[model samples]
Target: MGYYLMKFFSWVACRFSMEKCNSFGKVLGKLTWIVVPKKRKFMAYDNIIRCLGVDAGEAERIAKASWVQFGPMLMEVLRYPELIKDDYIKKYVTIDGLEYLQEAIDNKQGAVIATSHSDSWELMGAALAQYGVPLVGVAKKQKDSAMDRFINEYRTLVGMHITYTNGVREMFKMIKEGWMIGLITDQDPLWSDGVVLDFFNRKTNCFVGPASIARTQKAPIFHGQIVHRPDGGHHITIYPPIFVDQTKDKKEDIKKATQQIANLLENHIRTHPEDWFWLHDRWKSVREKGLD
Candidate 1:
């Protein structure tokens, strides 16, 4: 039932121009909030206050904006098949720091695009695709099979290759081809398998895969953020790549790489608190699992 509903929504989203679709998305977001803010409101409040270190009032404001962004965000994501067209790319996306990404590829070292859940992150991939980068991204499989297929297919509508989180062999093959693989380095990883890192002054388990991959593949790590402009367009600012050191100590290398990624994400979130998705219990590893 829900899958069909999403399919309907996707079809409707693609019918309108990107600007009109985005406007409709904001309306949807407001209706969603007014009708059913849902239980994530509690978690969103906690995350903003705990992670951003803001007062209750300020945290609530940031949390609300974050939730409000969902309408346009969902619209943008579902509009991928429509938005990835060449004309839309030139009309709406403003790309900067492109040379940094190109330079990494020029070195013959595959680059791991260290990404996070930011405003309009889905568009980030499409924007890069417009620039002719062979994109490969890793994501966890959705529990709903039909929804999973629907989502991933649209996710790669702009020429990206989406792989499951456990697709190690395929990732290795892509690395050998010097493809740029995108990994979200900020998600809370399993305490047992992940390394502890300090994010927003709190210790939590973070995925070390990007760092490990870079070290093993002799690749460089780069990060980007898609900031939503007031005019309804997005500007992607790609940061320079950070290379991992071959210090002989594997764990130490992982620690260094993970910290670099963590620090970079923290800075972006700090500078733009409302732009980040803060609904998830990102500190669960420390507060719940006692990773600290």
Candidate 2:
């Protein structure tokens, strides 16, 4: 049932112009917010209020807007087949800080891009690939095989090299080949595996994969994000790279690099509250372990 539903939506999205699809997606997102269960629904609101220090009214507004963006996000992802057309990237996606990415490629030293689950986040990597950057995105495999296959196909279709979370060896190979690697680091990691850090003033466990890779591989780490413009386009901003201090203790260096990423994510989310994936229980590890 889940697989068929995804296929149906993808089919519907492919048949419409992007503008039309986006408009329809807004309606779909609103309806989804209304129908999803209470726990799932309130999680977004809670995250906004507690983590962001927003009042209830403002948090609710931000929560709903995030939900609204979800529809357009899914629709845009499903429309990747059309997005790969010639000149599509040039028309809709504008990139800043190309020199940062270019520097890595030019030097034959691949870069680790630290990103989050922001609006049209998947599109960031795909757009770069479409613009001629050799990119491999680190992705978590969905539990449902159908959904996983559906997404991976489009990712590859748009020229993105896909690797699962456990494929660390493969990532090193890609980095050695000077291919940019995109890692979404916003989600909570298992308590045992993550490094606890301060996010929005709250303690939470964070994945250190991107930082570890950059330090070990001697690659530069750049913070990046894609924002949805008012005119329904996307603008990708990549900051200058930070080289992890090899002189520092290994664990301490990883923690420091990870903290820098958390700070960047907080800044972006504060500026664009609705862009981040608030639906996720970002502090789950802290809550589960009864950490203060």
Candidate 3:
């Protein structure tokens, strides 16, 4: 089932322009928003309401848009083969701060790209790779093996390196070899592995790997975001590096860097309410352990 779906999407991506693919994706997104189970719908709405401090009606609107956004995002990813040829970075994406990332690369210590599951994150790595950045994207494998291979194939096709969710030690090794590692640390982590952190005014389990990597390797961490634009293109902003404090207090340094990451994530979600992956139960750890 997953393989056939991948084939179908890849065919559509090859046969259609990005605009047409996006239009189809918008329709698919709307259908998904309508047909998704109540649990998912409720979780999205609840998260938006609590995190954004919006009323139910407003939250519902944002939640629907959130689901819809994923459609185009996936389509864009599927169209990567075409995008790679057309110089999409120059034609489609408006970059705000390339120099910051270049600076990280120039420093020769490798770098950590602190990004999240926002907009076309897959494309983010692809774009960086196209621009000659040694980008290694950390991804969660899909439940189905076929689907996982399908996704990773597209990643490698566009020159982005792949590592599984549990590849932190591998990430460090790559960093030592001067590779820029991208970590999507926005989602919920294992209860035992994550540290408690304040996100959107609530306590939740947060992955400190990005912070840990930067602190241990003395690599600079650069926070970045990608968002859809009104012109049917995308905008990417690579912020300046967030240097970790080497105060001989490893725990405190990781905590502070992770908190800074959490703060950046909250600000991004607030600014682009509909672009985030709200379908994930981001605060499940807090709720289950009664941390809130």
lDDT of each: 0.81, 0.86, 0.86
lDDT value for candidate 2? Answer: 0.86
Comparing 1 and 2 on TM-score, the stronger one: 2
Task: Estimate, for each residue in 1-292, the C-alpha lDDT of model 3 and write its tens digit.
Answer: 8877986878778789889988988998998887888899898898888888899999989888877887887887888878888676557877788898777678766989999888878777888888878899888889899889888988998888899978888998999988999988888888766789888888879988888889989998988898988989888888878999999888889989899988988899899988888888888878888776
Runs in model 2 deviating more than 4 A are 1-11
Which stretch of 10 consecutive residues in model 1 shows the poorest summed lDDT? 30-39
- After TM-score superposition, the amount by which residue 254's alpha carbon in candidate 1 deviates from its true location, in angstroms, is 0.9
lDDT winner between candidates 1 and 2: 2
Clashing pairs in 3: none
lDDT of 3 at 50: 85
In terms of TM-score, how similar is model 1 to the real structure?
A: 0.92
For residues 1-292, what per-residue lDDT tens digits would candidate 2 score against the true structure? 7677877877888899999998998999998988867786588788888877888899888878877888888888988878877778667889999888887788888989989989888888888888888899888899999889888888898999999988989999999999888998889887666799898888889999888999999999999999988899999999888888797599999899899989988999999998887777777779888974
Residue-wise C-alpha lDDT for candidate 1, range 1-292, written one tens digit per residue: 7678888888888888878878888888767776544567777787777777788899878877776788888888887767766568756889888898887667655778888888878788878877777789787899998888877877777778999988988888898887888887676778766888888878878889888988998888888888888788989888887888999898999889889988988899999898888876677777786554
